[model samples]
Target: MSDLYLSMGRKEGAAGSLYWAIQFTNTATTACALRGYPGVSALDTSHHQIGPAATHSGSSYGTVTLAPAHSASAIARTTNGPVGGPCLRTGSYLRIYPPGSRSAALVPAPWKTCSGIFQVGPVNVDGTF
Candidate 1:
């Protein structure tokens, strides 16, 4: 449950693909979850949401569900490459959540809650979570 890095926040063009990586340490015993999703936009504060691309942190050229004690993992390169102007280049973030299989009070959202949460990245703007 320590030394973790959930690499996310990659952007692409419309219907395009993206890439990123995730790494960790001292967590081979407990399975930790790294939630990759869009953060509050630096340009548009009123629109904290998904957008121009499709699968924002997904399963197939999208998000990643990292296993605990996994140490490190590098995401594949993206298909969309880059998009918009650098300002609209898109920004992503990562949240570290753990398994909620035996917990309560947590909603257990896939890539949001962090508990019983799943990895999602090479993020997109469509907000698939």
Candidate 2:
């Protein structure tokens, strides 16, 4: 599995958010899922790029399953919120794996993550690895 990070620009005075899209090539024979709905991350500039806002959801998007040998994509749109997690939106982050391959930590914490510095979720977040 792999991770990608994006730094977005808000529409002036609009709350900053995370908008992501994942494109993957099917390498496994079995069906797979591009997981990411309702993802949660607390406010920690040192750890997470996008900080928690008074109104955020778990994940911005998710794809239940993908056909084998087929290429697909998913999008996530994140925002700042109180509790729980982000909700499904146009853009989102996705992590894909073969049937039941999700382990304790499918994806690692982005080593070079973003800082809660800007309004668009985070500014110049580099920890997409």
Candidate 3:
């Protein structure tokens, strides 16, 4: 995990769905590989989980090999619930666990979500859905 850097990248919205690019950069001297969906969940200001963790989406699970300074990305999608609904809440951050790793990295991203139930896709080198 120390050899990787995690950050939120581009974002787009359509209708009631919000999508963000979760970027993973190889910061070490050699190459690394990432596979499958990363674990994602929303967090409050106190670093506590705000709601349920993100669910896995899509089926293109393939290994992405990253050279030093290279990057791979996954798409995270969340839908908005009705206003004043119990599932609607604002989160201050996103906790991301790289695939097959126990360590996590938090990225500051304040946004409204439906019970923090994000749908995350597999890591890809193209950084698109």
Candidate 4:
């Protein structure tokens, strides 16, 4: 997935939920298509997986196509309450995999996450916030 670049947008919050917009840009010269939910999870400073993988929270998913220099996005949410029990850990990074992709990208994120109950939406075409 070197042809694609992954980036996170500003965080938005309402009620008791925190939301993040994950953007995937096609940096190559050609267009590409992405479908389903992107794999997402917290990571320890050592790069090991932490907590349960983010669960799919949205309804049905649809294919997201991107043209060169264009982008697609997905939304991820986390609760304000502490996660996990006494073993609750702070994550130093976030590991992400685009829809139908095996390769992944590591994003720096300082967050305390529980070992359960992570949530993420399905990938959507460009301009989706």
Task: Write model 4 residue lDDT over 1-129, tens digit each, in one string.
Answer: 899899887787666566788888999898898888889998998998887888888667778778999988888777655444333487888899988889999988765554345688888864343
- Model 1: how far residue 88 lies from native, Å: 6.8
In order of appearance, the predictions have TM-scores of: 0.28, 0.30, 0.89, 0.87
Backbone clashes in model 3: 0
> When superposed on Cα atoms, how far off is each prediction in RMSD?
11.1, 11.1, 2.2, 2.5
Select the stronger candidate by TM-score from 1 and 4. 4
List candidate 2 segments past 4 Å from native.
1-18, 33-50, 53-64, 78-129
Candidate that would win on lDDT: 3
| Lowest-sum lDDT 10-residue window in model 4 | 79-88
Give lDDT tens digits, candidate 1, residues 14-85: 354433333333345555443343221111233333232222334443334445645434332234432432
* lDDT score at residue 125, model 3, on the 0-100 scale: 86
- Clash number by candidate, in order: 12, 25, 0, 0
Q: Which ten residues in a row have the lowest lDDT in candidate 1?
A: 105-114
Candidate with the greatest TM-score versus the true structure: 3
lDDT tens readout by residue for model 3, 7-27: 989888877778899999999
